[model samples]
Target: MTTMPRYLLSVFGPAARTDYGPYPSKEDMLQAFADTGAFNDRLQREGYFVFADGLEPATTATTVDGQGESPVLTDGPYLETKEHIGGFWVIEAPDLDVALALAADGSKACRGVIEVRPFQTAESVAALLDS
Candidate 1:
C-alpha cells in the first residue's frame, strides 16, 4: 500500500500587475478576488485542497533570525527581489505530475507562478534516524 504525499504550492508574483500604473482598477481587483475564490472552491470539491491563503503585502512583514534568546528582526524581506510570495496552498497528490497539474491551475487562478514542493513525512524522518 502507498500513501499520497503532501505538497506545498508557493505562489509568487509582483505586488500588483500594472503595465502603466501602480494599481489595478477596483472592478478588476474584485473580479480577480472572485476568480480566486471560485478556484479555491474547485480545489476543495476535488479533494486536492488541504489548506490555502493569500498573504498581506510584503511591506507589512518583519523578518526574524538568530537564536531565540537574542533574535534579530528586520523590517523587510530577507532578500530584495522584484517578486515575492503572495500565497500558498497545501495539497495531497500521488506524484509530481499530478501536483504540477494542480499547480498549473493554481498559477492561472492567482495570475502568478507556483512553486511545487513535496512535504517530508514522519515515516521518512524515522527511517532516516534509524539509518
Candidate 2:
C-alpha cells in the first residue's frame, strides 16, 4: 500500500500575542474565526485533514530539558524570537504543489503567514540512520 505525504502547515505570528493579526474590531476577529472554521471543515470533507490546532501565547509555554543528569524546567518558549508558531495543521497531500496550494488557503483563512514543511518518511529516517 502507498502512504500519502504528510505536511505541516505552521501559522507564524508575533510571540507576544495569541491572535494572528491586527483586528480593527471584534467583528473582524469573529469573521476571521468563521473563515478559519470553514476552511477546517473543507479540509475534513476533502480527506486531506489529519490534525490541526491553535497554540496559546509563548508566555504560557514551558520548556523542559532532560539531557543532563537532572532535568531543568524553564517557563517560556524554547526560542526567544520575535515570531513563533501560533497554530499548525497536519495534512496529507498527493504532492508538494497541492500542499502549497492548501497552505495558501489556510493562510488566508487564518489571516496569518504560513510555513509548509513535509514530514520525514520512515524510509528517509532509516536511510539517515544507516548513513
Candidate 3:
C-alpha cells in the first residue's frame, strides 16, 4: 500500500505578548487547549497524527541567520506580522484536499487560522540547498 505524504498545518493567532497584541483570556486559553486536545485525539484515532504542539509567545523567539562560520543571531521573529504562529501539526494525508479538510478542523480546534502545506522531501531539500 502506498503511504500518504506528510503536511504541515500552521496555526496563526493574535500574539500572546502584551507588547505585540491582545492576549486571550485564561478561560478562552483553556478552552482552546481542550478543543485542540480532542482534535488531536481524533487525528490519532484516524491514523493521521504525526506530531503537534503549541508554542510560546513570539517575544521568546530568537532569530538566527547568516550562512557563515558564525551565524547572526537576532531578537524576535524574522517577519514583522500582526499574527504569529501559535502552534503547528504534522499530519499524513493522501492529498492536498485531505490536508485542507484536516486544517479546517484544526482551525476550529485552535480558534485560529490554519495554513496547510506539504512537506518537502529529502531530495528536494538537498536540491534547494545545493542551488
Candidate 4:
C-alpha cells in the first residue's frame, strides 16, 4: 500500500538574545504574513500546501497540570529555554526529500528553524484529527 505524504513543519527559534524579525517592528511579522498571502495562495493551488498557521509569542502562554491536589493550572509555560517553538504547518508532499526541500525554503524565507517531521501512524495522527 502507498503511504500518504504528510509533513510537520515545526518552526523553531533561538529564544535568547538577538532579533527575530520581519525586521522593522514587532508587528512586522504580521505584515510579512499579509505580504505573503499571494505566495501562499499559489502554493495552495499547487495541491502541495494543505494547511498553515502561526503561534502566539513565547510569553502570553500557560501550562497545565494533570495530576495533583487540584489539577493545578499554572500561569505560564512549564519550562523556559532558548529554543522556542514559534509556529508550524502540516503540508502534503511526495516524499521526505520534497518535504525537507520545502522545509529548507521555509527556513530561509522565514529565517528560522523550519523542522520537517514525518507524520506518524494513524494512532498518532488520530488525536490531532479528532480535535
Candidate 5:
C-alpha cells in the first residue's frame, strides 16, 4: 500500500510577539482566530489534518544540546532571528500541490505567513543513517 505524503505548515511571526503579529484591532485578531479554527475543522473533516498547535513566545523556549559528553541547556530559541515559528500544522496530502493549496488557505485563516515543507520519508532517513 502507498502511504500519503506528510507536510508541515509553519506559521512565522516576529520573535517578540506571541500573537499573530500586528492586527488593526483586537476584533481583527479574534476574527483571525475564529477563521483559523474553522479552517482546522475543515482540515479534519477532509481527513488531511494530523496535528496542529500554536506555540509560546520565543522567550519561553529552552534549547538543549546533547551532542557533547554532557547536555547543555540554553535559554531562548535555537536560532536568534527576527522571525520564528509561532505555530504549525502537520498534514497528510497526496502531493505537494495539494499541500501548497491547503497552506494558502491556512495563511489567510491565521493571518500569518505559512511555510510549507515536506517531511523526509522513512526510507530516506534509513539511507542517511546507513551512510
Candidate 6:
C-alpha cells in the first residue's frame, strides 16, 4: 500500500473581506456574516479539509524574533502588504494534482487565492522509518 502525501493549504483572502465594514445598518453586517459562514460550512462538508482557521487583521500584529528572555519584539507587520497569509490547512492527499484541486476548492470557499504546497521530508521514507 502507498501512503498519501501531505500538503499545506495556505488560504489568502481579500484583506478587508472579514471587516464587513461598519455598515450603517445592522442587517447589512449580519447578511455579510451569513454569507461567510455558509462558505465555511461547505468546507467542513469537503473531505479535503483537515483543519482550518481565520486570522485577525494584520493591523494589530507585531513581529518578534530572537530568544525568549530577550527576544526582539517589533511593532507592525514584518512585511507590509494589503493582504496577509490569513489562514491555512494541513491536508493529506494522493498527489500534487489532488492537492491543487483541493486548494482551488478552498479558494472558492474563502473567496480568494489559495496556494497549495506539498510537504516533503529531506530524508527518504525508509530513513524515517529506521530512525
Query: How close is every model to the real structure, measured as TM-score?
Result: 0.81, 0.90, 0.84, 0.70, 0.88, 0.66
Candidate 3: how large is its RMSD? 3.5
User: Rank by lDDT, descending?
Assistant: 5, 2, 3, 1, 4, 6
lDDT tens digits by residue: candidate 3, 8-97: 999898754544233357777678779989999999999999999988788779999879889999999988888899889999998899
TM-score of predicted model 6?
A: 0.66
Candidate 4 per-residue lDDT over residues 1-131, each given as its tens digit: 86557889988876553353324555766655654464457558877788887776666577878777777776756778867777777888888898888777776656567878887877677988998
lDDT per residue (tens digit) for residues 1-131 in model 5: 98799999999976654344545567888998999999999999999999999987877899999999999999988999988898999999999999999999999999889999999999879999999
In model 2, what is the error at residue 49, expressed in angstroms? 0.4
- Give the clashing residue pairs of candidate 2, or none: none
- The C-alpha lDDT values of all candidates are 0.82, 0.90, 0.86, 0.71, 0.91, 0.67
Worst 10 residues of 4 by lDDT: 15-24
Sort all candidates by TM-score, best to worst.
2, 5, 3, 1, 4, 6
C-alpha lDDT of residue 126 in model 1: 96
| Candidate 1, superposed: residue stretches over 4 Å from native | 1-3, 15-23, 123-131
- Which runs of model 6 end up more than 4 angstroms from their true locations? 1-3, 16-18, 21-47, 67-69, 122-131
Error of 5 at 56 (Å): 0.4
State the TM-score for model 5: 0.88
Who is ahead in lDDT, 2 or 5?
5
- Candidates 4 and 6 compared by lDDT, better number: 4
Top-lDDT candidate index: 5
- lDDT (tens digit, per residue) of candidate 6 on 11-40: 664455433532335676576456556655
Which model scores highest in TM-score? 2
